[model samples]
Target: MPLHPACECHTATRSYEFSESHAIRGSTIGMVLSKQAIPDISQNGGKHADFPGAKAPYVSKMKFLNEQSYDPIPIYRVIDNKGQVIDRTEEPRIDNETLLNMYKTMVQLNQMDEILIESQQQGRISMYLTNYGEEGIQVGSGAALLPRDMIFAQYRELGVLLYRGMTVTEIVNQCYGNHEDRDKGRQIPMHFGNKEKNIVTASSPLATQMPQAVGAAYAFKRAPNNERCVICYFGDGAASEGDAHAAFNFAATLQCPVILFCRNNGYAVWTPTNQQYRGDGIAARGLALGLHTIRVDGTDALAVYRAVERAREIAIQNKPVLIESMSYRVGLHSTADFSNNAFRSVEEIQKWAQEENPVEKLRLYLEGKGLWNSDIEKQFAKEARDIVLRTIQEADQKKKAHWKEMLKDVYYVMPQHLQKQMNQMEKHLEKYKEHYPLDQFQSE
Candidate 1:
């Protein structure tokens, strides 16, 4: 049966048939079965074995399936690189307001990345990561989700937080680790979490959110008339982790309603996709794991929105889906790493940034629709920059979280040992107050 309209399962099936023919050609048992067969077992209403573990047809010949047995999964795309819709039928029926908001959010996200990355370079922030070329995947998927939907994001999905109503000030505060920050200056820059926004705090470890998101989905499944689903976002690099495989198996076996969204942005730090895995992209792994799978062109905003919208529909029906969004990381992995030094070329990054940029693609679409122009673009660009700069200024001026905040949140009640430690630190600070930057931190 056909799956999504953009899916090319037929091609996969045809490739598998061709490979199987070659695989069984030299086997004598296969040759004998071709010429002779036992009495039909279908007369008893069962042609395949009904084993406790699997229900599969019994083959007369031995065969092994490999990666080459199927064609690479086709990427689902609604628009071309020029931002023209490839299929009108496939275009999502998003309203002008929603479409405009998505475009604006992507633009804002791009602007934020530019400013924040520069801020890190200027020593304003300790570290940062940019969404860069993958803005469409973030905003498009964010637009498709409900406000109530829980999001488990890897560190790079700042656009999703912005779309989900996290304020610019809130983001800047987190980056600055100011007194107003929700995490009490505990996390690194870009590790955003808002309980009210339903986005879990991002951790530095790869793929840890996968199993946790599945556990949340299982809880939602057991709830009475559960209407919400969990969306777990990770990178292609994270998919290689054992936790990722565990999450996939448990989600498939327990039938959790979760969307395992993988951003295959060509590299995990300095390692490229070719070195990451030998098989087809991450979508192939999803297929083997028995999840509803789709590969999407992450640069096309419309395509991402349509793919995620459908994925959400399937997910809320108690089916887990995996979407591998393919794009390029036009920026460095983070402020800590430098690209174009060894692994990839600057020209290659420039090519993708110019021709396949998600922000520019959506801008072209909006321009074609008469919803955007050079004037609007300039105005919005200035406004976005002003807002980010203003937020950063305000956040930087704010006092840092109190020195004692580091020890306060670890326990519901301060233990005796912790209290003694806190007292010792307080006494040490009081004795050496002139040596430390006490004015920068909040007072006791």
Candidate 2:
């Protein structure tokens, strides 16, 4: 509250005159010193205070006071369906190897999802979720990130983990819940994680990772030396959760480097996106919360790569970003979703498959660039399926974890209550020796 040393004004009138004459109108000094409101231009038919420059026509603030809708957020795209660069000059100049890797990863993901989903249906695994139509967001956005960037992914973002160097065998072991599983068989299939890779364990509860991602980004901000960002992936349905709002607000207010990628895949399982919200989906919420927001076509890997690279560049400067990727859940949401075709029309799915297929789109683009061919693709498809089948078979040979394994990792030392429960279970199992599989409880 200290005044300038040479200031002579001590009276309210002198202060008012000084503020009115020299201070910036609505600027810091004028806002603090003056109480006079700007004249309403609607009454005098002159220039509006809010509108500094005269325009042909302007909507007064009160004119649409009752209106709630805002202008639509524009969609950004770098590539088109016909293997064309629509963004021409602005298109990202990704190297051939990197572009080929993106295409390869999408193919691997497509094959992996198909095999695993079939395995689940055959009851080889308890459950599985497929990223059938959303490989671009996982692969493209993931390819754009640095190695040290923390990634908290939804179940379908297997490509992100793959990009981060998680091996096929490791993922299959996690799916099988074998001895090689990172969580020691504690987590179910698809909830993969590895601290070494900075990929947080995925959760089943919707949007739970949002606040966690925000918290991690805040920690990164505090460290200052990490120079890393937290990129969290969730679906449009997950964005409807309360944690999402809290996470967005905190990230924006704290100016944390959190890149939130919401794959608006047109459904929360079976519930259509239209049934979830009336607003302009998740991107509008991000803008409303002061985060830099963009909506991009999810099927285009090049577009996703460019968009995420830009978002990452901004996030490193301590600004949060929200990317709502418009896609479709063209495959079963989960293995248990046997009635998927009943809830959604087959004709719509066929259209999406024929036109906006993520893997096929990238393949076409790669083929157009002379980076791929029908013969190579055919050979690669066979190799991809073989790798998955071999890995799954190897993981299956490891056998499921014993019941004793589940009670091992919960604490530094086993608590007395848990120990007591284990003792009681051991006694009960001994009494029913012939009623169950003998090796099921036995740790081998």
Score every model by TM-score. Answer: 0.89, 0.86
Q: Count the backbone clashes (under 3 Å) in each candidate.
A: 0, 0
* Global fold similarity of model 1 (TM-score): 0.89
lDDT of 2 by residue, 140-222 (tens): 89999999999998888998888778989999889888777887778879998999999999999999999999999999998
> Where is model 2 more than 4 Å wrong at Cα?
1-61, 65-69, 438-444
Model 1 misses residue 168 by how many Å? 0.7
The regions of model 1 sitting more than 4 angstroms off are 1-47
Error of 2 at 44 (Å): 14
Give one digit per residue, the lDDT tens place, for model 1 in 141-225.
9999999889999999998999999989999999999999999888999888888889999999999999999999999999847
The window of 10 residues in a row where model 2 has the poorest summed lDDT is 5-14
lDDT values for all models: 0.87, 0.83
Instruction: Give the Å shift of residue 174 in candidate 2.
Output: 1.2
